[model samples]
Target: MPIRVDLLALEPNVPGRACLTVKKWQGGEEQLEFSIQRNQDGFYLQDQKAWSNNPFWFKVSRFALAASGEALEAQVGPEVVDPLLEGGANSQFQIELREQNLGHADKGVVRPGVGLLPSTAGGQTRSTYGGVDLSAPVVPEPEAEIPELPELFLPVAEPEPEPTPAPAEPVYTPPPAPVKKSKKGLIALLIVVLLLLAAGIGYWFYQRTPAPAPTVAAPAPAATNAEACTLDSMNSVPELTFVQTCIKAAPDSAKLLEIINQAKASKHCGVAQRLYANRAQAGDPLIANAYAREYDPKYLKASECFPTADNATAAYWYETILAQDPNNAEAKQRFEELQK
Candidate 1:
């Protein structure tokens, strides 16, 4: 709190409205600032109102007395000093500053207690060294406290969170495609070929089986007499060939029925059956009914020809008769019985 500066001059002998210079040592030279003499004080300052706290006192511990050199030794520097902010940190180096020369540190004689010793020179100092008034009060100036500096703050930036990666999709995997059985088509074709071959062989066999030729019946001898009309002479009748069929149709219907009945009664049942099969297939009403009378259930007796009382050669001829003559009661009843 001690002031270590030279007391060069005091203007008007008053503390009010005095322009003073504050000096600081930097690089071994002085830097001066416009300041105020707050009171009859130890240090030059800028303004008295800038300090609100009661001033603290620090005396110059360096020896002080009558002028020791030709230069004015105004002991006006700070006493009991250590740098609180050295390299921006608290430091602990004991220091004691003795004096400071404000500006024009020449010729002005020193004063012991009252700051800025009185002088007059060149209108800057209105009094000389010999003009100082020793009668004034030597009240020492009060010291001031250096206010602690407000702390500076800097903002720090924050890092952004990294985006999380999406989960990987499952890979698709499929089973190998099944091998097609190439032989299956060939096998099916072989079976179809074999079936066609078998059918061809059966058809060939059926074609090779020869049918019996119609019996080449001998010609019928002319009726030599009524004695030729006997049953034994009937065997000599012409074969029922195409020419003989015309000769038979040459007869009257009554004669044709008589001839057919004789052929039937002569035990030529095969020929009769053939006649019935042909007349039934030909849809002849009279011949089909006549044939029906032989084995028709309506006319049946205990005869082997009508076994099961079935109409002759199946009910085919009787069906043919009734198809043409539905009013014929015999054909209708016999056809119905054959249905059973």
Candidate 2:
């Protein structure tokens, strides 16, 4: 039966000058104090007591005897086995070292007596012999041999001859003469020349044609002070100032037209009044009337300046105003009168 010992259990006992205290689990607690001291080459436990005849189980609570002592548990056999006595002179107990497979946090079991024994000197412990064996056998070599060669040979054969015949009279024929230069080449050359002449004439005509008198620069009109003053007034006023400015600056401008159209459509009375006043000052009675109708469709003053004598225009404006503001009794009456 092989003896097992936890190599990890002895980890605390590795460093030189360290003390370990082993506590036996069997009955009255017995403390085994061991000190790790440097021998000739390596470190070994020193000052350790020999085991008693009893089969005692012990654990190393702390090897360094530090505050948190490490535990190394072991089960010693019943025999008074002195490992130092077994291994020759000057040998120490080879604590049969093996890693503990202690599952998880549990400490693993160590079986002693299976490991190498230490050498002893005059009843004192000396050598440790727990190393593994690694010896193997060597193979022998074989002898070499030479190769052989072969011979060669040759052979011969015979030949035969034949007869010949006479030649016949020679025949000759002349090749056709080369052709003369034709009119086709002359015609092709004429076509090329004509094309070149036509191109040149086109270029000359193009050059001669004075590029239609470089468009006459239209004369800039004189600045109208009245228009400028109207613009200034339009800018100074709030609400409807944009519409007023548009009318003053560019009456026909689409944006301004849209703004006026929208104001009329929405029946914005204040905007319509401002628009009418601005357009009236701008000397556009037709536009003024159109805008005035947005506020007071029955406004006869605006009707009086109607662009069309048919009165249909005024009727349309009146109807539009009445359509937007049905409560406008004045617009309704004006519309009736215009119909008459």
Please name the candidate that would achieve the greatest TM-score relative to the true structure.
Answer: 1
Shift in Å, residue 308, candidate 2: 14
Question: What TM-score goes with each of the models?
Answer: 0.27, 0.21
The list of candidate 1 runs beyond 4 A from truth reads 1-233, 237-239, 246-252, 301-308, 311-314, 327-329
Residue 337 lDDT, candidate 2, scale 0-100: 77
Query: What C-alpha lDDT values do all the predictions have?
Result: 0.37, 0.35
| Candidate that would win on lDDT | 1
lDDT over C-alpha atoms for residue 122 of model 2:
25
lDDT of 1: 0.37
TM-score of 1: 0.27
Q: Write the per-residue lDDT of candidate 2 for residues 28-99, one digit (tens) a residue.
A: 212332222111233343324343333222333323322434333433321212322232211223232222
lDDT of 1 by residue, 175-236 (tens): 33431333455566668767776777677767667897798988966444333323454575
